[model samples]
Target: MGRRSDHSPDELRELLVLSGHALMGERGFAKFSAREAARRAGYSVGTIYNVFGGLDSYLIAINSRTFRQWGAWLEAALIDAPSDRAGRIEALVRAYFGFAQNNQNVWMAIYDHRIDRSIEIASEDDAAREGLTSIVDREVASTLGLNDNDARRLVRSLIATVHGHCALWLTGSYALLEEKDPAGQAVDRVLEILTHHLTPSES
Candidate 1:
């Protein structure tokens, strides 16, 4: 029974996060307060404070979960790719866009400033930068022939391209991938361009 009660805190926290997502998705973060989230979660405002320091912490928790989910999806996509490097890049790009479409609110929360600023949430910019560096260091630089600095630069470029394309797609600025199936084609085009730029010439 103790363990059952012990699990309640975590379960309640998850409920709060889910409620936060919905509220934030509907009204934007600034309009959504702790009381609102607590009400949505069917809990007391004090309960919310018990779980999270404030709305900022709650939003951070939600965004962190989103990042972890996206990262895991990308990692699996990379692992499931064909042996070729280009194939891996293509898989990564496809997975990213798929995640964007499937998790639009979360994607927007991470990308769009207006939405993010509402919650007073700090950008995940540094975390993303560090993550990009790790991917380049472990996967690209070490596995390939590139030095650390070059690998970091290349990874930065790739991240920029992905974010740019994803931002356009998420904001409906580009109608090219508005539909479900068009995402693969869009990713393929981006992968082709990246491959052409990154693949070394035959001696």
Candidate 2:
């Protein structure tokens, strides 16, 4: 039986999200069940729709939480990283691989859950994404001496470049291709781009 008044509205919202996150981590997106998540939280499935609008919004909330966690993982990785361009970038890439591998289910859920473009997620929910982007943008800007806007613009493709390598590695596609040192390849490719971006005087 589900509890009726054990938690406040805010607490219920948080509990549901935590419950859903754990389920996503356990089942990934393909097998995740909203009913199961609510059941774990000692609530009815209708409570999820009532509190979060629908399954998609609840997932957006979960993914936003994941973004914050990923950002923190990156920060932790930098704690022992060398204070240099290549080293910092390498640390970021390795952290990306480590986090995604260690938490593949939840990590993949971040990409697997889809929503419409026009739907509005609250600003606080997006703050996590902004923090993750800020970390990458800062590193890229520092390495290449680019302004904030330019660095942010470039960070998109730069992230994709590394993500392609990491994703392939995770799914074992790299092994199928017999690719060696994919992480090293991604790091070197990034460094090559940074080196090529030198100003006329430096070049």
The root-mean-square deviation over C-alpha atoms between each candidate and the true structure, in angstroms, is 5.2, 2.0
| The candidate that achieves the highest TM-score relative to the unseen native structure | 2
Model 1 lDDT, residue 46, Cα: 77
**Per-residue lDDT of 1-203 in model 1, one digit per residue for the tens?**
12335447779778888887777667654465767877877776877667876655676777666776777777777787887666666677778787877887766776433334445444653474366336534554444445667667766776666677677767777554555555565566556655544547521
Q: Which ten residues in a row have the lowest lDDT in candidate 1?
A: 112-121
lDDT string for model 2 (112-199, tens) is: 8777898988898889878987898877676666776777777887888888887787677735268767778888887787777657
For all predicted structures, in order, the TM-scores are 0.69, 0.91
Leading candidate by lDDT: 2
lDDT of each: 0.65, 0.84
Clashes of each: 0, 0
